[model samples]
Structures are given as structure tokens and as C-alpha cells.
Target: MQRKIRFNKAPLLGDDLIYVEQAIKSGLTFGDGTLTREVESILQDQFDDAAGILLTSSCTHALEIIAILLDLNKDDEIIVPSFTFCSTASAFMMQGAKIIFADSEIPTMNIDPQSIENLITPNTKAIVVVHYGGLGCKMEKIMNIAKENNLIVIEDNAHGFFGSMNQKQLGSFGDFSTLSFHGTKNISCGEGGALIVNNDRFLDRARVVREKGTNRFNFKSGKIKKYEWIDLGSSYLMSEISAGILKKQLLNSNKIQMGRKIIWMRYLNALSEWAEENDITLPSKPHNYTHAYHAFHMIFPSFETTKSFLKYMEDLGIEAISHYVPLHNAPIVLQTEKRTKELNLCPNSSIYSDRLVRLPLYYGLELSSVDYVIEKVLSFVVEKQKSKF
Candidate 1:
């Protein structure tokens, strides 16, 4: 039988055509077009920040910009969780700062704030937190730690767009928050990102930095007669085509979020009882935090069981799979660190990376497909149990 489900599918609303038609009509297809400006305004309202919003080619670029704005250098240390995408650490590494890997709270699968306190030293410059699976981390504890040390707080909110904590949005909490609009994310423009600058000190410079160190933004707004390179910067601006697609996605954000939430809940309800009986761990839902449900991941008893279960599901035509290999264990990271000794430090990260697998949860997934995936998973677990008896 053909695979009954796909990992993700982008919603193809007429927004792309509208953006294309607008681009052609205006004869402005490059960056700083009308669409880009409109999207910036929309994001400002969406993020609850009236100060600065600069669009970038991707979240990686946004993080890079944050590193530059902070002027991070050698001797500076940035605390990061080992169980996250490489970009979280790489953005700081590019600035010649030392990366101190922290452990995760296995319950929520987010960075442990208590572990962050243990990792900070005199050289520490920032605490980079990733909102794993669109769920908020323990921000109150994190913010308290940063406040005590006067460290910069940068949120790698790549997986969290509409997610919130204490009724406040994730992107608005940190000094600088970066969001991704990659194809896999809830919101997509094929490839794009935005940086929400909460502090005014970085506003003027961020705009120039994103525009390749030019005051071109000021020039376009008639704030300057002629724009020139006034600071060290790179090309991080998104094109009009990308901005147009993203703006369309933004308009449909509510509908998309609601649909994904339903799928996420279905998975939770279907597997909750069996998961508990088998001693399997399910994703935790905190009281004050609202997850955007970007992914539905579960932890199996052992690495071997996870592998066997994945094979069983595949045989039943479901495309369920595993997620990130911890950055600390990756060859590139090891080469950069030039030390294998540090590899054994993150034991919790190692375990989660080994046994966790993600289920397919996306907008527009059929209800029947949801039931089908859960049925297959249940059958696989039951058969596995029988073999031992």
C-alpha cells in the first residue's frame, strides 16, 4: 500500500499568486519592496513589538546578526542546550565565543534552566534558549538567571511562532528573538526569517546590518539623502517573493494553529493510556504554556525498541521517524572543539536523542490518517510485548 501519511505539507493558498502579481505590477521584485514593508508591519503587530522588525534570509542569519550586535568575541561563553538544532550554537561560534552545552529537562524536552545556572561563568555573554516542539521553556527561571548575571537572552524561537507562556508570546520575552519560516514550519515563505528586537539600542543598527551595513533603509524612508556602508554587516535581507509568501501565511495563522492543535491532541489522547501502561513517556503539557504543536514526539523505552518500532510502522505504510542527533555528538562539532572528552557530559541528551521518534502532525492532515497512525503504533507495541512472553 502507498504511504498513508506525509511528514508535512505546505498550504498552497492563493497568496503566492497575489504576491507574484503584485511584484510584477509594481516592477519591484527585489528586497525592500511594498510586500516586504507590509509584512514587516504585520509582524510588528503580531509580535507586539513596535520598535524594530528586520526580515532576514533565514533564522540562522537572524542569530548571526544578534551575535554581531552583541559584539561577542573570544573569551565570551554562550550557554546552549545540547539537544537542539546546530544553528543555535553555530550562530555564537561564528563570533569566536565558547559554546557551553547545557542539559535538557527530560519532562518537557526543553533546556533546563537550573542546568544553565551551573554552566555560566565569568566569560558567559548570553543564554540561547530553543523552544523545542513549539513549547515554551521555563522562561521565568531563565530570565531570573540572566537578570542576576546581566547576560543577554536570545531566544531561538525557530519552532515557536504563535506559542506563548503566561499569556505572553515567546518572541517578545528575550532581548532578541529569531523566528524561522522554513517550509517545515507552521508558517512558511519557502525560506525566510525575522528578528524581533525588543531593545531600542539595537534597532537602528539592526536595520542597517540586515541591509548589508547600508543606511539604505533610512534612504528609502527619506531619512537620509544618500546611504553608505556605516557598519560591519552582511546581506541578510529577504526578497519580495519570499516576503509575499510569508505575509500570506501570516494571514492564515489562526486557522493553521487550530488545525495542528487538533491533530496534536488526537495523538495525545490515543497514546496516553497505552504509553503509561507500557512505561513510555509522552510529551508534557504545562499549565501556563500553550504549545503550537509543531511536532508530536514520544520517547520509547530503549534505542533498540525505537528502531524496531519505526520499522514496524514503516511496514504498515506510516512514515513516522526520529529527530535531531545531538549537536555535541556530531562530527563537525567534535572537530571544532578538538576534544572527545566533552562528549560524555550530556548523558540526558544522549538518551533522548537515541530513543525519541516524531509522528506526522501537520495542517490539513485527514482525521482518518490520524486514526490510522495511532492504530498502527498500538498494534506494533502490542506485538512487541507478545514476543517477550
Candidate 2:
């Protein structure tokens, strides 16, 4: 019997056992342990120009801290792509800021720089850019707009660890960048995240915020006699056990990345012609951008066609699924006055929500498994065409 291929799978080596055993022996199972420090150090080293790095419980928490550091007011507005996870906009919304949903470029599924500039107003405080599927956004254009407007740039790089554009890393482009290490992500520690502060001024505040408003981090470093609450914050730190697992994953990142890339390329090569002949659209790779192969998605002709294809694939024991719904249209958006029609955001996002399907591509997934998935998908397309007769 063969194992069924999953849409996304985590690569956890036996090294996690060693780390857990070491953490148990050290007796520092909480957040402020050597393992946590090591994980932060690894992040700093990888993101070289970062002023500092703070580990958080999840990317959502990292985004929340960024909201605090931004000091958003009730009247402030933050522009975001509509085709993203809720955390991208919810973080700012939580700070009482208005969310201005921006349209995404059809080809890359990233925030359109032109639309971003058009949406800027006197009350605009920041622009949140999500590097969708580990593909870098149009940073140069977006950064130039932000600089001209004197607005902060926050990067939602949850899917883009180790992804780069024009030789510069993705996380370094903005004032702050957030990463996720959830089980479903390219990297995993069960549930963890990190904040990369590019500007030195935000580092101290970020540290205090992550440490539950205490100066404990400074106190532990001998910079202060004792730690105490100095500002509004929360407990966003990751446990030592989680950090220990992440350390091992970081060490083996190259192997994991390589395997994922091979799988991604295999799918592209195998399905290119079929995709073209069927009038389906594959993902676009922008110039100067290197993707981490976080996901492999394609657009079908229509929502009905996509649904039909998914059912056909499922019948064949191949589980292909769709990506996010347009957040601007989600019910949660109605709670706030930020109406979906106001921004004229991404008509394409609605199209993607209805028509796109994501296929499986995980590290350590066997070549035979890849072929099986492709075969099933191609067969579905052929059978669906025949059934239309």
C-alpha cells in the first residue's frame, strides 16, 4: 500500500527529538531559554540587516504587535490586498484603523502598486504587503510610494521565508516583516512566528511588546536592574520547546527548500502543455523574484468548471483544493464600515476565489506520488470535457 499525498506536509526530522530531550535536561521549557535565544539569533543572521527579531506565538500575534508599534489611531487607514489571510488586515483593524482593500495584479496575485498609490490619502498610516505564495511583491514601486507619502510599510511575509527579489531578501524591504512557522507553512514548529524589524527605532518597542510590556528582556541582559511593565503589550513569545524544534528545521532549511523546488518544477513541467491547451493559467514568476514553492495553483475557466474538476480529482483519490476567499467580501468585513465596494479592490480576487485550485507539493513527497497527482488531474480535465458532450 502507498501513502496518500497531501496538499501540504511538514518535514520534521528526528532532530526534534534531540532538541526536546536537551530542553528537558536543561529545565528551561518556557519562553526565555537558550533555545529561544538561538532561534532569534538564527532569524537575525538570515535577515542580516534586521535591527532585531522577536519570536511570537503565531504570525497573527506578530501582526498584532506591529499594530501596537505603529500606534494606529481610529482615523488612520492601512491599505492591504483583499486576497489574503484575515490577519493581514485584522491586525490594523484591531487597532481601530480603517482597512482600505487594494486590488491585486492578475498575473502575480500581489497588491497592485498603482492601485496602492491611488488609494493613499491624508489619513493613510501604512501599506501592508503580503508576499503571496512566497513570490515577492513589486517592492521597489510600493516602497517608493510609501516613502513619498511618508507612510510605513509592513510586510506580511508569512509564506516567504528565504524568498528574495533582486538579490534582496523579502523581509528586509519593509519597516517590519512577519513570518509564520505553522504546521501548514513551508517551515514548521507546530505553531510559531517571528517579527523582523528593519528600522532600529521600532526594535525596543517590539521587544517590550513581545515580552508582555515588561523590560524583562533588558533586565535579563543586565541592562536594567529589574523588569517591570512599561507599556501596553501581551505574551507573544514562543515556548522553548517550539524554538528548539524550529532551530533544527532552520538548520535543515536548505534540504527542505530544495526538495520543494524540485516538486514545484516537476508539476510545472508536467502540466504546462495541458494547462495551456485547456485555457487554464499557471502562476507567474516575476523578474528578480525567487519563489519558495509554497504552493502550486492554477486558474480554471469558471467557478463551475473548478468545482467540477475538484470533485473529479477527489473521486480519483487526488485532493486538490482552492485558496482564500476575498477577505473584503467576507462577513467579518461587514462588521466594520469598510464596505467591499468602497475600495474597488481586486475583482480578480473574486475570480481567484471561485476558479483557482491548489495542488499538493511537499518536501519528501515521492516522485511517484507527483506523477499520480498529475495523472489524476489531467484525467479529470479530459473526462470533464467528454461529459460536457
In model 2, what is the error at residue 113, expressed in angstroms? Answer: 0.9
For every model in order, what is the number of clashing pairs? 0, 0
lDDT of 1 by residue, 1-389 (tens): 47668878876655456776777678888887888889989898878763688888999999999988988789999998999988898888998888888888886678998889998898999999999999999889999999999999988999988889998888888899999998988988888899989888899999888888889988999988999999878999999888878888888888889999999999999999999987788888888988978989989989998999888877777788888787777787788778784657678888888889889888889889999898888777789778899
Compose the digit string of candidate 2's lDDT tens values, residues 1-389: 54456787789666566786789899889896898888889888889899989889999999999999988899999999999999999989998999988888876788989889899999999999998888899999999999999999999999888899998999999999999999998889899999999999999999999999999989999999989999989999999889888889988899999998998888888898999999888877766788968888888988888988888776666668898888877788866664555554568787777888889877788889999998877776788668789
Worst 10 residues of 1 by lDDT: 11-20
Task: List pairs with backbone clashes in candidate 2.
Answer: none
Q: Which stretches of candidate 2 lie above 4 Å from their native place?
A: 1-3, 338-345
**Candidate 1, pairs of clashing residues:** none
Error (Å) of candidate 1 at residue 48 is 1.3
Each model's C-alpha lDDT? 0.87, 0.87
Instruction: For model 2, state the Cα shift of residue 342 in Å.
Output: 11
Tell how far residue 286 is off in model 2, in angstroms.
3.4
